[model samples]
Target: MSVTAVGAFTDEQLELRKTVRALLAKHADPAAVRKAAESERGYDAALWELLCQQVGVAALAIPEEFGGIGATAVETHVVFEELGRTLAPTPMLGSVVLAAQAILASGDTDACERLLPGIAEGTSVAALCWTGAEGSWDTDNVGVTAQGDVLTGSSHFVLDGSYADVLVVAAAVDGVVALFEVDPAQDAVTRRRVPTMDPTRTLAVVEFAGATGRLLTSDGAAALERVREIACVALSAEQVGAAEQALANTVEYSKSRVQFGRPIGSFQALKHRMADLYFLVETARSASYAAVASLAEASESAASDAAVAKVYCSEALQSVTGDSIQLHGGIAITWEHDAQLFFKRAHGSAQLFGQPRAYLTSMKSAAGLTA
Candidate 1:
């Protein structure tokens, strides 16, 4: 949705989005992005420093008392939408959506104080360690066990886990949801990279064998449930941005490429398709905003709303990004074009936390469906 249409972004929020867009335009060049995605680091550290140290995007979600902008969920959503447009290889989502949110939501003052500043300033990177074969976000799926503050068991598909200095792991201790802070350097932990469709965003299989960990919180299953809902909201925002970008690229390419005697964009069939793509993107954006607003309200129905947004947005993004590639014809299939990058990102992001089908099922159950 356009800033003008949203009508909710204050001048400051608009300005922040503009600034991030311009920064990405300048720094995340096509070549640079390709290189970062292929690199071992999985993201650009220098670009991350510029965002955290210079531009202050990383600090936007942190509370003002904790050395951040203290922006609300809606404002944070704007920032993530801009970030996704660039496909900037950074850990903004992992840090803010997973780590920072867990610490803040846990009501652990010591942990927040110890970790927030570093996360805000780009000195520290953290990953959310949860996900298994079913790729479930439910508390029971958390097989990693915490015993007397020590954590053990394996967490698969930990985003950014390979490079993070700290890991916020969700585990079950006698069926009670537990949070633990794991140091990657410790001897008890081992991390192996998982090759993914989108290399820019890293994933890893982390094994915690009697890993020494600091207890972050023990609020039972409720803590993990809340964190999962928050993650769904943030992810939906990113998918909206990805879908929008893919559509924009297709439009730009259609206008520039000539077919028959004129630009392909002038063709009636192509124009209608692009128009439909635009509508889908806008609908996804609206759904995403609704999710963010509901999350901010923390309503009783927020979880269901977030799940609906996630499922719808993921499906929309998959459709839009695929059509974006197809609309570009053979050129989109080549490695030189950026269309493939977005297509892969869309595919990968769809499975993060859980895929569209999983969310759809969860949403149905949340609505009290018997079948």
Candidate 2:
């Protein structure tokens, strides 16, 4: 599919982005982010409530009937980008985007009606337990299995899994993948928080021992694929935003940080590097915007756009953050500086959903380019 220019943002979208940015600037500064990341819930509950109540961020993509703002992925993209800029740890990605989209894709009206309200309001958390220990996110590699209503086995790398009120699982059943809703509070269910390189995000391992689940969809491979595509697109926006912010911070530092006689950023070599980073950030932003546009429009090229956005944005963010560290010198690696946090976020996000190599391989296979 040929890449296209992103559509101009509507007035509301621009305003929404401004509102979210302002909120994050006020509430999720670097110190606040660090504090939240170290907290028990791994996020700022008060800020999350503010975002939900004021901006209606969690409700942006849900339909009106589901008690949402009846907006599109573009709106969610706006919010995700702002959240990425601050590396604010929140359930918006895992619960609002991943699990909510998975439930919507299941085409279970009753399930949507039952589950989406709390998610829309940011009052409840939901997690999608799909991948295994390998974190491949492949439909065929789903870790859990279902026999009748009972689920067994464990899923890893589950976002917000340790504290989610609802668990939407993709499990193998009779040789096919299906979606099941499991209550995390059930006696048969166990959740454990896992350590991660990125302190700004939370992941968990959920094990089910003959846990009873309510079937959402009997055939869920297609739904799972759809959710993955949407997730890739959404994540791409975050990567772009983070990359842009990283570059901005580096540039600002270059202007202020003096060397022997002048600012380090005034040096020709540093200027060139920053220029290259700028190019990467701009291109990645374009790719992310196009992907979100395609998804919002339900365009035929949405899947391919998502793939391109995921791979390109991941690489761009990683490259930007890596250079950011080098430019910032030893201070970048110190615990007191924010550069290290950006670097960690880049690496962690590159591995989230799936690695860039994984997406490239899938794209090549889909295009019949595989040997």
lDDT of 2 by residue, 1-371 (tens): 12235548878888998999999999999999999999888999999999999999999888889988888888899889999999999999999988999999999999999999999999989999999888998877789999999999999999999899999999999989999999999999999988999999999999999999999998789988999999999898888889999999999999999999899998999999899999999999999988988888789999999989999999999999999999999999999999999899999988888889988888889989965
User: Scored by Cα lDDT, where does model 1 land?
Assistant: 0.81
Please provide TM-scores, in order, for all candidate models, with all chains considered together. 0.94, 0.98
**How does candidate 2 score on lDDT?**
0.92
Tens-digit lDDT string for candidate 1 (175-195): 777787778899999998888
Instruction: Give all candidates' CA lDDT scores.
Output: 0.81, 0.92
Off by over 4 Å in 1: 1-7
Best by lDDT: 2
